[model samples]
Target: MRVFRILAVAFAAITSLSAAPASAQFFLKPADLSGPRVTGNEPGILGQTLTGATQTELDAALVWNLRAALNVAALQCRFAPSLFTREYYNSMLEDHAEELAKAYKTLGGYFERTSENKKQGVTAFDQYGTRLYSGFSTVGGQLSFCQVASDIGKEVLFSPRGSIDRIAHERMYELRRSLLAWGDQAYRGYFALAIPRLPNFNDDCWDESEYRAKRCGDFFASNDSKSG
Candidate 1:
């Protein structure tokens, strides 16, 4: 109960900023800022995306995603100090929204053709359309900050931006790792059977699903079930 409350408070603080293109895009909150979200976790809740995917397909998808983070976008480009400027970061996303959308569409088409998303129809990962579309947006943001951090010639702990950048990097890196780990668990809460069980951590409840459902509502619901 206490942990759940803390997480709620933490999440509120993290989300003080309103919705935008990158709320859950690149950086995680302070809790996730430190490490991977799925370290030593089990496959508990399968959402709409993983509904049709086999473990193998999900694993491949995981690999594709992680590699995309590492090999594409900012990882591929030189992390020049100049790229760290906030203006560059914000402007590029704004200017290239159309181009990026087109590219993502092409990639989505390619993903649909993959063994995982295309078992029978383009429905396996259909639920994750939004996530898949925007997941990579944050990498560029993180990379921009990382480039700045690199130029500062000190550890991220040295300055506020560096610290934030460092947190963003850790969060992004761990998010990739978590996506990979999630494939192995194969559990879907509320939407599907709850066999494997998710991580027994405070944060997992919030991340797995927040919407209402009959089967797993109490289970997924935070201890503060008293709240509205």
Candidate 2:
């Protein structure tokens, strides 16, 4: 539970930052999330039908440790035949999901969000009882907390397995794509607002800034000549 403890601390941090900027922030629905080109991960799709799974089956799904926790909390709605319907210790999330999302809303930012994007990372422990990792990161923004719990709600709608639902895994892939797209959009707005003083990319928006005197001098020069 040491790793879980880190998540609890993060929720507290999120609560204190409730005044997080709302002007440039955005919302994500499943529809606006279909276009990202994920190069390195497996597809985890949903809405599939499983004919033979039984309520007593004990096999874990794919990698739904968080969802497992939510199952324990009963915060998530369970399908009649899910492996997660009964409360289990292993499937429980470290914190309450809704509170985590509420706390996250006030704390999201370019600096904070970008810090969590990774193709992948591992969550494991050593035998010495030392805490190796305080958090977890996926391709999306940092999901080390209950922000991902919201997805768990939707993910529970189509359970093919108990702890490791295949469709849920596919939805995770979509979530990574959607979060990336959202991050890109948020950064675009951030740069748009920052253009007055930072007319150049300055290593921040090296690939983003549409107009930059430092990196795109030739492009700007051509525009100036055209105006002349």
Best by lDDT: 1
Candidate 1 local distance difference test against the native:
0.36
Per-residue alpha-carbon lDDT of candidate 2 for residues 122-170, written as tens digits (9 for 90 to 100) = 1111210021011122223322112333345434433223323343334
Q: Tell me how far candidate 1 lies from the true structure as C-alpha RMSD in angstroms.
A: 16.7
> Count of backbone clashes for each model?
7, 11
- The TM-score of predicted model 1 comes to 0.27
What is the per-residue lDDT of model 1 for residues 110-154, given as tens digits with 9 covering 90 to 100?
A: 457654546433553454544553454444235333332222222
Mark the 10 consecutive residues where model 2 has the least summed lDDT. 120-129
TM-score of each: 0.27, 0.27
All models, RMSD in angstroms: 16.7, 16.4
